[model samples]
Target chain A: AQSVAQPEDQVNVAEGNPLTVKCTYSVSGNPYLFWYVQYPNRGLQFLLKYITGDNLVKGSYGFEAEFNKSQTSFHLKKPSALVSDSALYFCAVKEGGNNRKLIWGLGTSLAVNP
Target chain B: EPEVTQTPSHQVTQMGQEVILRCVPISNHLYFYWYRQILGQKVEFLVSFYNNEISEKSEIFDDQFSVERPDGSNFTLKIRSTKLEDSAMYFCASSGRTSGNTIYFGEGSWLTVV
Candidate 1:
């Protein structure tokens, strides 16, 4: 089975400061991890994904995530935060192959304050 | 960038009424999926379709739920008889090939059962 855990229900950050939303996963084989953001009343927007190659994967809107195999973690990070970046963040994982479906985490609410 | 699109941004129906939610996936994508998020809950997978057939589905996708690719460009999810608990935001997603690919999500259709 594959699953992801977003330990924090909410994360607060000040504008211009770095932000981190933790995510950890469990999978039978190699994991394909993803980060998506959802603004109010909108659908989830893909942020980034970790498939293979480098440990650090950069994505849209200046966000990135580090895939740590040892820790079974794929934590989303932003070098600097913006008030507009505040949204609901979700972490999802899949055991790569014909699975076709992702195991999702309970979203973490991010609030960036100016 | 092309995107997946969903119809009926919002809908309200009485309990036990049948509801059909529609989606048009990215033209070039080969895999399609449906997921739902009840308020404050995780985004749960409903089903995945490829080659006009369901490749996978979650436990939440019970007998009450059925999916159809009625045409080359459209995918629909039908709820046989909606319950109050079925109220949720339904998201349609599509990917280029497999689970490892980055999937794009539609804005979602919000369903309210009375």
Candidate 2:
């Protein structure tokens, strides 16, 4: 079994400031974690993924997420936020082994203010 | 960049009518999946296909829903009879690796059952 939880429905951050979108997961085995962003009326775009090795993975548009094992978390982060970075973000997980189903988060709408 | 492309960006159908959503995944990908997102809801996994058969599916992928690799280049999702609750955005995704791989998504096909 696998699942993802994004506790926040929305997160607000000032432009040029740092931002974080929290994500937690539940999986019976090693988890393949991922982050994706969706703009209005657009399909989701892959941000980054954590398969193994490095705990910190860098992704598109200067986005990054850290894989924290003890906490069962993979939090998306950006050193400096931009107004254009505001969008709906989702966290997804696929349990290792033969589990092919990718469980997704409810999503978090990020708003960046200037 | 190569991408997963979906057809009929938007479709409107009456309740009880059948609807087929189409997608063309990246040329070399071997794994295919379908997911849906109702307006203001989390993205839900519907089904995943590999090796010419279904690899996994969620409870939401009832008998009313069917998927096929009808031809060489296209994958399709067919809903036997759409209901009001069926109105949502459908996404198609694909991945190349067999395990713990990153899946790329299409822009999506919006289905509105009236």
Candidate 3:
């Protein structure tokens, strides 16, 4: 079945350090991948998406993700972490077609310490 | 920028009571969707509505669940009889005319069943 996997349950980074939240997906067709962030008590907020373009896609809040087709991965990254960036991150995927539903990954909680 | 909006940011109800969650999708969007996430769990698709009808729904969207675009502006999800397992954060989302367009989500309604 089509699915998304966020391997890390939690990631910790000191302020100003680079951070990474890993994601991998398996789908039958071209995959539309997305990243969403959720602050405590808030809903999912779109961060970035990779449809068909350059491998590097930048999103809101200085976040970027690299879509690696060969590895079946779309890992989220940030050059510098902020305490404010500490939150739950989710990776979702949808097959390219008439399917409108998204397959979600178990969220990864990131904690950026000052 | 326009964004989806949902009402009753939080609601608590006894099991077996009926609950309706209301949403106002972005004015220009053509597709609307409902999804839910139990505390500390991955997001799950509930149903999708388009052109005044339900286009898709997951197994979780059983007979107890129903969706309606009552008018031009409001989309609603009604639970015929709530259960303790129904406690979740319900998100309302919308997208442009095409399936590839990014789906923007609302702040979500937290439904607590006791």
Fnat (0 to 1) per candidate = 0.95, 0.90, 0.85
lDDT, candidate 3, B51-84, per-residue tens: 9999999999999999999899999999999999
- Of the candidates numbered 2 and 3, which has the greater DockQ value? 3
How does chain B score by TM in each prediction? 0.97, 0.97, 0.99
Report each candidate's C-alpha RMSD, comma-separated, in the order given.
Answer: 0.9, 1.0, 0.6
lDDT of 1 at A95: 86
Tens digit of lDDT per residue, candidate 1, span A1-114?
A: 678999999999999999999999999999999999999999999999999999999999999999999999999999999999999999999888767788899999999999
DockQ-based class of model 1: high
The iRMS of the candidates, in order, is 0.9, 0.8, 0.6
Better of 2 and 3 by lDDT: 3
lDDT of 1 by residue, B4-39 (tens): 899999999999999999999999999989999999
- List-wise, what DockQ does each model earn? 0.89, 0.88, 0.89
Best by lDDT: 3
Misplaced by over 4 Å in model 1 are: none
Candidate 3: CAPRI quality band? high
